[model samples]
Target chain A: MAMVDVVVLVAGDGVNRAIPAMLLLLVVLLAGLLGGRLVALGVALVAAIGFAVLLPPIGSPRVEPAEDVAALVLFVAVAAIAGVLLSTIVLSDRRRLSAEQGTVEALLRVDHDRAALLRSVSHDLRTPLATIRAAATDLQGFDHDPAARTHLLDLVIDESERLDRIVGNLLSLSRIEAGALLPERQPVDLAELVAACAARLERATSKLTVEVRAAEGLPLVKVDYSQIDQVVANLLENAARHAPPGSVVVVDVERVGESVRLRVTDQGPGFDPSVRGRLFEPFASATGSGSSGIGLAICKAVVDAHGGTIAADDAPDGGARITVEVPIDG
Target chain B: MAEADVVLIDDDASLASVLAVGFESRGYDLRIAATGGEGLREIERREPDVVILDLGLPDIDGIDVCRHLRQRTTSPIIVLSADGAEDRKVRALDEGADDYLTKPFSMPELLARVRVAVRHRRALAAVAHDEVLSVGDLAVDTAAHEVALAGRPVELTPKEYALLMLLVRNVGKVLTHRAILDQVWGPDQPLDTLRTHVSHLRRKLGGGAGAPQLVTAPGVGYRLLAPGDVVS
Candidate 1:
């Protein structure tokens, strides 16, 4: 009676253990289809170990060790295949996403260029046409007035020069974009550069009081002199154009350790919140309609070429500030 | 100062012809060239005090043209480029251009540049002969490496001295940021350092705190004010 009771208890325990082991095998098989190779391999390993531990001693009467090894090899193969498939899908999706992003950026640039071309063309063509128009208008009244004729000729000359400038800017933009533009880097004194830029700004606008600060014993920096001049000039010009009249345009330059920063701060309404992300993008002007927007974009590209970083932010004085930072060699 | 003769080169015939009349009215002797080769040939013939060379040309690369012209004459060459590439301007200057005007520049601005170029060229020639610079109360003796104000020696640092020499050398003429950088700092120093140094020099030169003798030209470089030029 005692032997029969012990046998019944062992049987009940074995049945209970087999059900869970079998359920675990089912979970592993299903997981192998969707999981990556590593995950599938982990599940398979756990299931195999669990089954071995749970199997009754009666199972020792059945399969050979070589057959068991073959079954383990087959499970590993399936897990590896699942992992490879998952990796391939993930990689391809990433590639597609980047390519799409590249296409959109290119499209945006193209649109910007087209708009710039049109704006410049219209403005340039207008000047020459205005000149010719005035000339013809004067010629029609030539017999009656010499002063009118002289004035008309002057107008023609002025307008023609304006057209020339427009054409020049268009060509310049192309060269810069094509990487054909090269800067003659040299040691430049910031104090003089700022002072010069400030003087010009002072003369150009009554709307802003321009101030320049250059500390004593500042070190000279390597740069393309004319190019930097253009950068500073464009910034000041942009500030003068955009900042409200009677506001201040502060052009400041300072040395940080291992770097130098030049900042052009303006007292006017700051950047439009909508286009902040795209501010450095070509033609992404904060001023809604009138600004070329290419000015800041070109500035950013030029600074980048010099291995410098440019950023725009609201000024402490409550306007816009454009800061350019370039690394100095140790 | 009397008006100076200038040689203007561009392929645009109508525009050139109109500009000729305009320059004439402004008391300038103007010569026009339609091509790079012709402009070069013209430069050899007259050696005009100033040459306004357009970058877009039929025969030669504008940079090459600038190089060739530089080899032939010391006359100030002001490049007129349609491209705003800082690199292009730097290259032009490297190739011997003294300055540049981007496309769509204001006529008044262009004329002002021309005037400065002519004045600068004459100034350079004068320095080659006289070797001294006198502006307002400041006198720079280039040969002696000396600066004096009202007959008193003004002490300056090595960098300040170099900066002063550069400014005095090109007095009344705008030196671009790159040009000044190249002249004062060795070419290896970065631009931010250049700005920092310029700031330091300004403070040292008494261009501090509202009173400034040095002037900044927007999108360009620096210029030391000429005599009688008041700063408010």
Candidate 2:
């Protein structure tokens, strides 16, 4: 302030003099924001004293001094600077509030999703339990034909398997969420993994057969064997649950570029475009038919843990297709 | 597989009860012991043909019981365990349990495993070292040290022959890598080399329908499937 005042005094005081003084106010405002109002007040007082020492006395009469005009210009500049600084504070405060509101909105969305997942899981678990209870309860009376009794027993077994799948998926998802499960890595053959998964799921899937067309001599993808099996099994399970009875679920595996790409195509109802966006979310079953609902979520988590990518889309021949790609050495 | 005597050690009465019903229908006499000590005493007294031990015994650690039982009896010890720990299962198998069934296993599946274990023990008891052993169309003539698949003699290297003979002797059983390595390569070989050898053998044994399959049990072991046998 003293430097600018001396310069203005030597060069004839003008409107430009107030511009430098305005910069001093901006510095004070910035200091106010950084160090609180006390520091700002101290800086402002020093600036005012500097101005007093540098400027002409109030009673001094020079040869046609334009002190009134310069004082008016300085006052206006100070008011404009103060106005902008105060608006900046208010604007920043508003931005912070909106940001916090965004966080709250996100949290609400997550809470709603959690509630939906719980409902879906409860429904899924209870459906199989209800089936098992009804079948076993009927079988206990021992009044039905042998074939009927066998069918009831089969239902109990099937429902129990379903329950097992749901429980397994929930455990896997929780482990993933807790970051407790570190995949034990191995050099695994993808074809073998698919075959093992198909064999395991064959009993549970009543009609749909997991037909694999794996390219021979696939590079041994370094991954966690059991984890990858879970991923493939979940995909096949989802396919079997959705595909029409007696339809073939085609599992295609091949080395695509640097990654091994696995695609499971089901002749079921294709993914509705609306739900495709959240298809990987837990409990987002393509068809709401008693699916454990965490299948895709498991697939996503396992594949992600392996540094791989998973995707879903409508098949060209009127079905849904889930594709997964894992690096050979990942 | 006549009506074999069995001793089951499980704290869960529900499993014991269910297995009792299952064994009765399957023509086996089951002796239940709720604790590991009782199980060992039963084994000492009766010397059953098969022992089903649940590793989650209330009184003792299942693995220690497994070790003790392995030292006490020649009967096959088929372990019952909860899932999700390959290490525990491997340790059990390494502790001399012939086979294992994960918990919540279906009745039929458990029965199948029991049958396999009994049959395995019988095979072990009745082994004549010089006799010919076969699974599906693949046969190993111990007399001549020759391996043949589908009437076609498939020449194998020493390691390959040893591996094939080991698998043939224990047909329909999942042999852990360590088990195979300990017997074939004397417990000193890397697992990756074993995998490579298996893949080579699998490629050599590749055929059309009815070919014997060296079915892979991921992260655990391999099972040789008879030509027409379906995977469990």
- Over all chains combined, what TM-score does candidate 1 have? 0.50
Off by over 4 Å in 2: A1-330, B186-188, B207-212, B225-230
The RMSD of every model to the true structure, in order and in angstroms, is: 25.3, 24.2
* lDDT per residue (tens digit) for residues B61-175 in model 2: 8889999998999788888764346887788877878777765555556666677667666765666464888766777898899888788888888998888888877776678
- How well is each residue in A94-113 modelled by candidate 1, as lDDT tens digits? 78999999999999998986
- Docking level of model 1: incorrect
> Considering only the true interface residues, what is the Cα RMSD of candidate 2 after superposition?
11.5
- State how far residue B31 of model 2 sits from its true place (Å): 2.0
lDDT, residue A315, model 2: 90
